[model samples]
Target: MKKRPVKAAMIGLGWWGRKMVAVAKGAADDLEVVSAVEPYGDTAAAFCKENDIRFFSDYSAALADLEVEAVILATPHDLHEEQIDLAVKAGKHIFCEKPLALTREGAVRAVKACESHGLVLGMGHERRFEPPVAQMLAAAADGSLGRILQIEANFSHDKFLSLDPSNWRLNASHAPAAGMTATGIHLTDLAVKLLGPARDVRVVCENLASSFPQGDTLSAHVRFKDGGTAYVSATLVTPFVSRFAVFGTKGWIDIRDKAHVESPDGWVVTKTSTGMPIEVSHVPPAEPVRDNLVAFARAVRGETEYPIKGSEMVENIALLEAIIASAQNGQVVTVA
Candidate 1:
């Protein structure tokens, strides 16, 4: 017997939400975009009409549609928690964009809501699905990286620099710690995945070029309870700079991105060992965003567990909160 694709509603029609719809269009065998919810009714209605999907201006109206098995949230950061609560009450599986919640408590509540309901809680961390990153995580998990000592990463770009001054992304309240919410949070999620939960953090945020209230450049130092350390940074006013490196006693692995996750150019990876020749390889461009969506759909179908664990989701938010606190206070803050 053939299984049907998961019928889902995308609850935001922003750029990224539209991208998800396009990706899901390509993966029709596994996931189906049945509808969408957006406050911008006319634009969203036209988009949905062109795509042959239903559109609703009210979120609760979409949730009441029994055919929507899941909801994908690509909305603003501040609305994630409240929206997740609504989806939970409606008995829908959830796939939320990154920095799931601005605060640890909110993240904990979101995770618990889904867990208690036995609903799949998918997160938008497509980086882990990237070929080179998956390879790096495999090496770390299998002890090929030996005793991990440190990881250094920087994910930066100038994409948001030209946004209208009033855009939520440029506002301090929605996107704290400069590019942390925009880009650095992904770095922290990967860091915590490899190094375990963060123990403490120190940070510096500065507005060097752009007029963004939360600043344009961010640098963070994190110490993991298990002894690994990480230097993470992001800049909102730079050419695309995506790089991740892990150093261990036995060997080291470095990955550099030729394009951002949204564009999917490709990746160059270099592996070095104590007495072996350096190995370098190029990973072809991949649709990691689609890959993540399919993975979430599979989890919703009970075919497999989602890769990003619930604990990691909460821990990433905790690390994010600590980073923001440290940046604001100019002092180290413990990750709660």
Candidate 2:
């Protein structure tokens, strides 16, 4: 059976949103970007002309169009919940990027709105679609990890030290908990996806040497609902590192990627059995952002269901908020 492509209206023409569109072009066969909402009138007009997708200054104009059946949001972190509510109300299926909302209550409200309209709500947690990550998650879930004991992960980079103060990445409210929002938040979602919902979080965010208030380092310790523990760290001024590992009584699996974004190849995974190290192997590279978009298109077309449910989304946001609260209050915060 052939799958029909989804007709989507993309909201936002920023770098990330534009990259999403660029990756989908000639790559995702099941996605058709029919419209775009960009506040910058002239730039949006030029982009729409080149891409051949309709451009509108107001998102509501795109929503009003009958040709747009879905909405793809890459807007600011704060507008997610409100925009999702409006999109669902307009009867459009939605695909929003990670850190879905700035807070848990907002996430819950957005999820409820989607449920009320019976719209498919998709998220762009691109790492979930990475082959190595999928393999590690499968191993953890399929008993290969044997009562998973601990998970350790880190995503560190030095981009923040050179960032301008006005950049959204350096905004205080947008990313108050240092690299928690920019980098470490994905690890939190991955932990919850593989382990379970977070019960409590202990975080310490510090600005080691930078003068910026956004901070430079974030270290979080999370306890899962199942009593499993995880340590996740993210830093702004550091060598590029992407390391994730999960250990259990039986054995452990480790993943190492040389770069933060797309690398020349996929991640290298090392495993152990009987307390002896196994040879590391390369996992086939995948375009995760493209895969994530294709997955959303598939779900909207009814070819498959979206993997991240509304409930899971709420939990992820709650965990993020708890981490921020812990770091600010200087105490462990329980995730509600």
Candidate 3:
């Protein structure tokens, strides 16, 4: 007997919202987007009409539907806490976009609410589903790279230079923290997933370009609980580059991009002890969105664990709070 697909409602019709729709369509066997809520009436209507999905301007209308078992939030960062609370209260599972909340307290509250309700809460740290990143995490856990000593992850994009100042991403009130929250959160979350928790964090933020009212670049130095150290650099001052380097006592792994770790030419892995280089050849996994949505749907169906947990999201938010505090105080802040 075939089980029915989990029905999902996506909130928000921005860039990420459209991408989520595409992913849900590709994985329609396991999940189906029954409806969507978008404040922008015209855009939402057009999208729904084209995709043959129901659309509503009010979130309550969408949430009122008993057929929708899960909600995918693609709204602005500032709205996550309140919306998640509402979804949890409504007994709907949730898949929220990253940097779960702007503040530590908000994140904790959301997690507590979901836990109290016994609902599945998943965060969108989709980079973890990428082939190279997944492989690296597995190897690190298996001690393929002995005692990871240091990690450096960087993400940079110059899109802000051309973006409209009125966009939500450029507004500090909406984004809270600038470069780090907007782009670097992915790397920070990845570091935490691979190296456990970060203990002491020192951050520096600079307003390199005045295109947006907020700072354009942020650099964070973090020490892990396992005595490992990492640096996360995020900036809108350069062309787009997404790279991560993990160093350990025995070897190191370098990932050029999250999506193409397994190119036809293969990835390069080098051993520090033997000084031998090996080309790792494996097919890249499916698109991260597909994997992320599938994982969330499976969790909803009781077929698997959620790819990311609410507790992990809270921890990441705590780290972000520490980073922001350090940037503001101009000193190192200790993580709790």
Q: Among these predicted structures, which one has the highest lDDT?
A: 1
- Per-candidate total of colliding backbone pairs: 0, 0, 0
Give lDDT: candidate 2, residue 314.
Answer: 87
What is the full ranking by TM-score, best candidate first? 1, 2, 3
Question: Using Cα atoms with residue i matched to residue i, what is each candidate's TM-score against the true structure?
Answer: 0.98, 0.94, 0.92
lDDT of each: 0.92, 0.84, 0.80
Instruction: Assess the local accuracy of residue 262 in candidate 2 as a C-alpha lDDT between 0 and 100.
Output: 42
User: If ranked by lDDT, best first, what sequence of candidates would result?
Assistant: 1, 2, 3
Q: Which ranges in model 2 have alpha carbons more than 4 Å from their true place? A: 1-3, 262-264
- lDDT tens digits by residue: candidate 3, 158-200: 7678777778888877764457777788888888877787898
Clashing pairs in 1: none
RMSD of 3: 2.7
Q: Tens-digit lDDT track for model 1 on 1-336?
A: 888999999999988899999989877888999999999736888999999999999899889999999999999899999999999999999999988999999999999999999999999999999999998899899998899999999999998977889777888999889899888988999999988999999998888898888989899999999999999999999999999999998899999999887788999999998899999999899999999999999999889999999999999999999999998967999999
